[model samples]
Target chain A: MEELTSIHNQHVKDWKKLSTKKFRKQTGYYLLDGWHLVNEAVHAGVAIHQLIGTADQLDEHRELFDDAKAVYAVTPEIMKHITDTVTPQGIAAVVDLPDAHRVPTQPLTGAWLFLDRVQDPGNVGTMVRTADAAGFTGVVVGHRSADLFGPKVVRSMQGSQFHLQLFEGDLTKWIADFKENGAPVYGTQLNPQAKNFRDVHPGKTFALIMGNEGQGMSQELLTATSDNLYIPMRGEAESLNVAISAGILMFQLNQ
Target chain B: MEELTSIHNQHVKDWKKLSTKKFRKQTGYYLLDGWHLVNEAVHAGVAIHQLIGTADQLDEHRELFDDAKAVYAVTPEIMKHITDTVTPQGIAAVVDLPDAHRVPTQPLTGAWLFLDRVQDPGNVGTMVRTADAAGFTGVVVGHRSADLFGPKVVRSMQGSQFHLQLFEGDLTKWIADFKENGAPVYGTQLNPQAKNFRDVHPGKTFALIMGNEGQGMSQELLTATSDNLYIPMRGEAESLNVAISAGILMFQLNQ
Candidate 1:
């Protein structure tokens, strides 16, 4: 492992760019922080471009060296310089973007999720993680939603992206595609006339659309959905958190 | 109404202490930020102890002053000093903690949620909001859980706390009480032998226990439930986020 200590080092400056969405998109890579996420990336066989860590961290987790393209031991200050969080974890990795696009898994034969402009990075990541947990085929991150590769979204995804497929596209297009293919496409909203979520039974193929945290799915997309359902608010809360709503729907609708 | 300019003012100093659990408990108060939450608190009838805001904030939100105990217009710097976030919303309130104790809404009726040591402030708050939305009787935060009065938790609860009942105590005791009363208490975990949550139809009344983010419910508490249910994961992620799991169970079990 190469040891680097200067905060102004070119490598350090380049790595820091991973924290921004623009840089991530330009470079086709993102930063993975913390041991668990990095380990998950390693397990999922993500191409690790660089593994940067403090001396102690590298010393304890020597096995990480076996899978990465390169490993570097850096001073704490240098490590901190390359990360955005107030407290930087000791180890992180720069990973090449994997092939994230997925659709018609087995040609329209599995559950999928479409997030419509869910602006919050945390919510976007949670929906992806939940979709992965529910055995969904993939998640379509709608245009205008939080950047799927943004640092916050990456952290919240908890490396689940490596486990399943993720795609960025227009939610309405995905809804249309599913509907055209004869698969059920359910758009979640607060429509009073929509059927209750409990009454819906999903078969093997479906696309569940969860809308924005504030302004829900675009009006056009909702109208295009094969059906719509609302989770009844039995209590006084105005609505369930968006990510939670997505999870409940994914699990309940998963046959 | 009083206008205060200095962050060093005693009143300002006292209000700043609200971010901590100890100070919040000792003063029987906590800070509420953003217009939506403060407005929700007002609508829910929670007694407002002090309203603090920048002059413009006060001007724009005059209605918040109508019933508050006292109102003060402070500098933007003072608003920043009194809040936890780097960018303060410019308006906030010091509110007396409302009575949060609850057991049976009508004695032996209504679904109740018990959170067993769920430590994330966001998770704690989301469960409260979900409990309110699901129309659960109330929520019981067990020992070792996140502070109910913490700022993050309060923000996430979003005034739902005022709409429904919330109590803090031991999970074991609450489980015993609900079981003794004959309302089926369902503890959610990933135990393979546990019945699926979907199979258990929550009637007019029952108790649903959600475990902590990392540990799930304590062993003793799980054993004391009327039954245990699992949200079967059809996908590969190890587990669902705690708040998402709580929301799913709350809606599934809410008759």
Candidate 2:
């Protein structure tokens, strides 16, 4: 039980760097800021590289020490210095980035969600959680979408990241793979000419593509989808929030 | 054409106060940030108390001046001082708060969404936008929900606030009113005993209630509804984001 009271500690400095995507890429690990996420990672068998917390938090959650390879007790000020949140939750974990390329050997199955440059971390995270609730098997976060392990996205995902397979890759290739395998890939747009989502009935294996906050699905991916779908808006609202639209489509298609 | 050069100007000082809920209530006005929201407010025929902008913004949107009762040109620094966003869009507005109690004399006809103690500003705004997209005619925001006009909520709303009637009131009373009028009021929760939302077929006039983010619904409201409804979860995620749940429920109920 090593006690590190200085925010200048090398380990603390390294954990603080996890806040940036480039740093997380340089080192295959990300920081989980609160007890809820840390607990979820441990329960899901994620490899905990290290666990750092205040003396009181470490004592209260002493059982979690068994799962971590290293544990350090620091003052609240040091804990705050290591996490990005305005008020640190007093405990954090450094977990190895799960392998995104680990798609099962079996044929692609179940509902899959593809993000096409969805930029907002909150929107990206909410859609992932909704995909999990809707029974989607995995999410292929397209290039230009918010980094999956960014602090904001991780906080919003609320531990659903561990429940579903998440990958970052080219959306065009993912759509092609789904279509070639005979699974329907539905692209969403506001165009009236597109088929209404309710009219398109999908089977157990399908993919839904959500686009960017403003520009929407790239022209390439739009052309790549099997058929484009649109949710019927009966009111004067110009469009639904990207995350909202994704939830509606996921629930409807998964049925 | 009055040009104000100082952040200390009385008008600038007054506009800055609008960022707080107390001042908004005291003055019956709130600030609309950016060109998008200001333009929407003008087009929607909302009463614009005053329009404040930097020199370039005033010139570019000169046509909007006719709709605003008073327009003031200010230095970029003053514009920044008046707005809450990190980068002031060079334009902002003071809009008289629309009367929330102005429910139509006619019976409530279209679907109405009710938010109970949903505290996240982003969640509140997204749900409002979704309600509009789903053709929900109005939203009754109950006590403890985020202030509808808060900066984060207003930003996330993206002008959908102008598309729907938003009310702030007691959830119990709103639920009772709908029930008394013979329209089924559905409450949402995660308990297994609650009826599945898919099984409940709502007509054009029913009301749906969404509760707090952490706590699903107040016990009182859960007991008061015609029936409590739950969206069936097929995966291991504990629950849906409040806004996502609201979106799924609103779209499903409207359909």
RMSD for each of the candidates = 2.3, 1.5
Note the residue pairs that clash in candidate 2: none
Candidate 1: tens digits of C-alpha lDDT, residues B77-105: 98888887788889898888654554434
Query: Whole-model lDDT for model 2 versus the true structure?
Result: 0.88
For model 1, the superposed segments whose C-alpha errors exceed 4 Å read A85-89, A99-106, B61-64, B86-89, B99-108
Relative to the unseen true structure, what is the C-alpha lDDT of residue B52 in candidate 2, on a scale of 0 to 100? 86
Model 2 vs truth, CA RMSD: 1.5
Compose the digit string of candidate 1's lDDT tens values, residues A3-29. 888878788988987788778778888
DockQ of 1: 0.80
- Two-chain complex of model 2, DockQ on C-alpha atoms against the true structure: 0.86
lDDT winner: 2
DockQ of each: 0.80, 0.86
